[model samples]
Target chain A: MTDNQRLYWRATRRLTVGLLLVWFAVSFGAGILFREALDAASIGGAPLGFWMAQQGSIYVFVLLIVIYCTAMTRLERKFGIDQKGSDQ
Target chain B: MSGPLWSWVFVGLTFALYIGIAVWSRAGSTRDFYVAGHDVPPVLNGMATAADWMSAASFLSMAGLIAFLGYGGSVYLMGWTGGYVLLALLLAPYLREFGKFTVPDFVGDRYDSRAARIIAVICALFVSFTYIAGQMKGVGVAFSAFLDVPQNWGIAIGMAIVLVYAVLGGMKGITYTQVAQYVVLIFAYTVPAIFISLAITGQLVPQIGFTSESVLPRLDRLLVELGFTEYTQTTKAKIDVFCITAALMFGTAGLPHVIIRFFTVENAQAARRSAGWALAFIAVLYTTAPAVGAFARINFIDQVNETAIDDLPAWFETWESTGYIDLDDKNGDGVVQYRAGADNEVVPNRDIFVLANPQIAGLPAWVVGLVVAGGMAAALSTAAGLLMVISSAVSHDLMRMTFRPDMTDKQELRWARISAAGAVVAAGLLGIFADNLGFVAQVVAFAFGLAAASLFPVIVLGIFWGRFNKQGAIAAMVTGLVTTFSYIVWFKFVDPDPAGWWLGISPEGIGFAFMWLALAVGVLTAVATPAPPDHIRQLVEDIRIPGAN
Candidate 1:
């Protein structure tokens, strides 16, 4: 593979792994591991840990996808791999 | 109008509309049949995927399951939706760049081996069939409860309606029809939820209404008073919750029907955006599900707890006639004390909660009918998608690619239709005979577990890891499939509780263990074996480089 291509691949992998860590934290972390601690706090009248497990994590997941989409679009442009082949 | 008549009108109208769509969008070629001619826009594809992915289990059963399981049910909420992130980022775009008609097509070409393709086909067929069986049973439950049709007849009617669209238009018809079904099912799901939420908490949005101070603490106290666990407290073991959630997330990514929905879009970028759209659409129902669960549980307890059995509401009587909810005077006190124990007199089927919620809440007859129609839409749309995947596995992967290399596109399309019809019949039979298997939700979980263990690792590694060869891919698929399937069958059907389970992971959560096993075998085999052929390496590079197409 060319150096540019290899660089693009590496950057993509780094971005994906980073985003995945966030995903894991919101779900497996707040929702599961630290659920008891969060439950002691409250959100919108329900326990925060319960809300995170049931609702908050899902909202975070949707946000994570949106972030990944926007970030990837920008990365593709920076790497000159965008569908239009222009920085814009 | 009577409830059954109203249900018929709504269900019949929806069925007619689906048939109209089938006739209008019938497939004309192999490409049209398989991938909707690869011309569907991202937003429409997203809607279609949402409908296709949200099966009867999601619409009719999940909220009921959640309502009963309380906080433990977050596994379904998180596991099912969280996988979209994996699909959008790790799998969908690269597979779209590969630009294949089916998932097995990607596997076959990636490994450059027909054997790999066939194994993938077997895995896809197994998952789709098991998944479709749950959809068919969902159809049966909805029909029997709402329309008063016998369970077998419900399965047959659902099979016939699905046969019309899926056989005629193939993926093209299924795609457009699914978009319509999504609108119907989501509206049907949220309207009743909104009504219940407003009644209970005076909040318009069910998502917030559920968490709002209006109802939860009271319900949690009531549950405790009734000797039940707190509604919002953690009830399941954390390890089990973690493993099951992981299994579901990975399993969702591996589902062939969902993956194939991405292929209908135009490009990798559209595929990425479409995944986002699909998740947004799915979130509409998923976020509402918890609220529905909470409201329904509260409503159920409010109406039934400490009430005389004979004086129970008409909805209870109706649900009892369907054998879903039973009232027995176990203590001979003649009052229903709804509590969690074998001695408890009231037994409510988890599947009945969602369908019965409208009636329990005293909603209008039309709303109840709409809920019925929505349940049917969810079941039929998902069944159509699964049948399509099974058909393509048979016609494209097994027949044309493996057996008849010289088959024309016309012949292949004919075979695809035949296979779809055959699959519907097989699924219908399975639905009828496998009534004892488990609830719709449990059966679908098995499908997800199998998919997560078998197809997920291979597909993810094929796109990302350049050194993953055919041997490693096959070994991973086989080991994952065998271990997961054997564990589930042994625990579920054979032993009912095997002492051999590691860390006390139930059959529903065991797939994640096998997934790791597959990953280890795959990496080890890849390292030990020679690298894959150079052409395969170039193909991997091509798929990785965005816009290469």
Candidate 2:
């Protein structure tokens, strides 16, 4: 593999691993594991944990995907691997 | 107009529009049939993916599930949507770069083994067929309720409609039709939600309305008064919720129909962006779900509790005749007291809440008609996608790749169409027998569990871990498939309870445990076996790079 390809691969792996950890923290951590502890607090007139389980985690998931897309696009450009024919 | 009359009108118009889209987008060749000639725009492909992903379960039954499960329902919400993150970051771009017409094609090439390909085909067919049966039943339920047709006839009619588009237009036709269906289903879902939210909490957005001071606190108070647990409390064991949620997330990413949607887009980058758009479109309905559940529950409680059985509201009386809602005059008392125990006099089917919400709130007849159409749209769109997957698996993977390598493209397309028609007929029969099987939502969960345990591990490991070989993939898939399937059948059918389950986890959540088992077997086998050949390792690197296609 070329130096550029190896660098791009490492960068992509780092980004995916970091983002996945965040996904786990919000969904499994805040949403399920620590839910009762978080429930003692409130958000928008509902318990914080309840909101996270049902609503807040979904919003965060959407945000995470958007971030992944943007960061990947930048990484592709940096490595000169961006598709020239892409609609983006 | 009368309710049935309005329902007929809405249903007829939507069917006509779907058929028209199918006619215009009919497939011309194998490429067009399988992946829409790989020219679909990212955002448009995303909308189609959303429609294909949000099946009848999402449109007709999910909010009802949430209404009944309360905080326990987070499994559906987080599990279904969080898988998109897995798809976008882990699966989509790499799979798109592999440039295949179907998922099994990639498996066959990556593992350099026809046996691995065949196993993948079986897994895809198993998951798609199980999921499609639930969609057919969803169609049946909507038709039986709104159009006053028998459930069997409803399944046949849904089969016929799917046959027309799915056989003729294939993926090309299904894609555009799904885009149109997405618009209809989302509009039909959100409009009634907006009205109910405004009436209940004076908030325009249902997500905000759910947390509004007017909604949750009052519902919690009334629930406590009636001897039920507070609506938002975590009543389910935390471990069970975690297992179910994890299974669903991985299963969603592994689903063949959803993964195939990425194959239709122009490039890997478009695939990534498409995954984002799909989640955004899905979130519109998902986020609104809890609010809809809250509104429906509040309305239902106010209408039934303390009311004399004979003096119940017209909706309750109507639903009672359908056997979905049963009222027992326990202790010979005329008054009905609804609560969460076996001693309660009312048995409310959770599936009824979403379908009956508009009527319970006294919405206009047209809104009810539109919601029915939306439910059918959700069912039919997903059924078409699943049928397409089944057909391609038969014609492409089983026939062309395995049995008849000399077949021409024209012959392959014909086989694809024929297989699609056969699948629709088979799924229709399954729908007819669905009641003997189980509930639509629970049946769909089993499909997810199977996909999670079997396909998810192989696909992720094949891409990320180049050391994963044909032996490891085959061993992991068979072990996962057999373990999960037998456990579900034994508990759900044979014994129905047994002495105890593995660690007391129910069949719906046990697939998550098997998913970990599959991963462990896959990694251990890879470490034991020799590494794959250099060409296969090169293929992995090629897929990892974005523009390699």
Candidate 3:
């Protein structure tokens, strides 16, 4: 693997980890732990905490995956690792 | 005669449509059977995966669980959907690029050991069987409730339908049928919710309706006045909640049925795209669930308390007489008061809250029929998906790979169909055996814990750590299996009830904790051992490359 390849992989790793962190925070963080604090805040007449636990976190999760997918396809193209059969 | 007849008509029509699709799209070759010939468009795959992922538990049990547990139940809603983030980002792409048939194929090829694949086969079977038990019985319940038939007969009918499509079509057929199921289920799920939301908050959307202004100011004030939490209030134990959420998150990424959906797509990028699409599709349902749960809880309490019990609406009287809803005037007050905590006197059956919500909230009968149809779709789609995977594992992984390497592709396809029929029969038997089991949610959680404990760690280590060998994967799987299984068995049978248990946490919640511990120990043993051979390294490289021909 060359420098370009290494850079590509590193970028991919960061993007993956970043998405996972948000996934953890929204679901385990806002949805579960801080739900009461969130309840104090309001969204569309519903408490923020209640909304996050049920709906908001899930919406964020879908967005996170779409973001990751967009980021990875770019990374794959940059590293010349775009889907292709190995020349074995 | 009214509701049950409509349910049968809707359910029966939906089943016929699925059978029609399966017959039309049945796979011809081994590749077609295995990966749907890798031609499935991303959007179609997304719909199929949604149906495959949403199971009886998600459809029949999740909102009911949330209705009871309040904020704690968000773990399931978030955890299950959030898992696709992991799948889209890390797992699906590489696995699709690897282009093999099953997860065990990835394990076996990556580790360059037949032993690794064998271990995976065991884990998949274990997970599938546990999952199937709950789903099969769910079919029985739905049948008994909506069709006015015996539970055993219901299971037999469901088993027959699944066997027909799963055996005839394989992955290709199952994929298209799953898409049809997704449409039926989503329509079924949202229609009643819309009516319930309108009735409760005058908001069209359930999510918005949950937070909208209440019809009765006094009722809202009463909730706050009586030390009862507000309808929108969120409350949960944080740390234990964290563990439960994490287990579900990882468990979702680890489920075989969900992962195999990616295999049906054309490329790694499409796999990732499809994962995103799946999350979006799944989110629509997940978000609606809490609103439905919250609104249903509020509406139910109000109805039971204020409606003078005798004139408690036609739906209630109907379900009550049918033994579905049991309402007791404990204090002779003739009103139902629903408060949090175990000590709360009024305890509505959790299952009835969501299933009967359409009727409970005065929705149209047609809408109620749709909800029943939706629940059946969820149960049937998932059951078929599980059956396909189990059968493929038997025919492809076990027989073709190990016993008869020279077997023709034609021979393999035939065996695959046979295996599917056999698996359906076996699952039907298990359903009959566990018919009188406890809550649906509890049984499903046990299966998730089993997947988390037995498969997640082994697969993760094998993919990322070069030192992970066949022995390590095998040992980890076995350790996780034994620990998780025994803990559940002990809690269910030997240990005292939840209140008497060590932590006051129930068996359903505690079983996964034991599984994680076993996974940790097993992975460590693998790390302390030797590296796999060059072929294993090659396999890893193969999976990593975008185009590996």
1 versus 3: better lDDT goes to: 1
Writing each residue's lDDT as its tens digit, candidate 2 over B277-376 gives 9999999999999889989989888889888878888889889998999889786788988887766889889888877888888899898889989999
Note the residue pairs that clash in candidate 3.
Answer: A45-B211, A46-B211, A84-B546, A84-B547, A85-B547, A86-B547, A86-B548, A86-B549
User: Considering only N, C-alpha and C atoms within 3 Å, which residue pairs clash in candidate 1?
Assistant: none
Q: lDDT by residue for model 3 over B55-98, one digit each (tens)? A: 98899888987776666677788778877887887788778877
Q: Interface RMSD of the predictions, in order shown?
A: 3.9, 2.8, 3.2
lDDT of 1 at B346: 88
Stretches > 4 Å off in candidate 3: A1-4, A84-88, B215-236, B333-346, B437-441, B497-519
Can you give the TM-score per candidate against the true fold?
Answer: 0.97, 0.97, 0.93
DockQ of each: 0.51, 0.61, 0.61
Ranking by TM-score: 2, 1, 3
lDDT for every model?
A: 0.89, 0.90, 0.77
Give the poorly placed runs of model 2, Cα more than 4 Å off: A85-88, B437-442
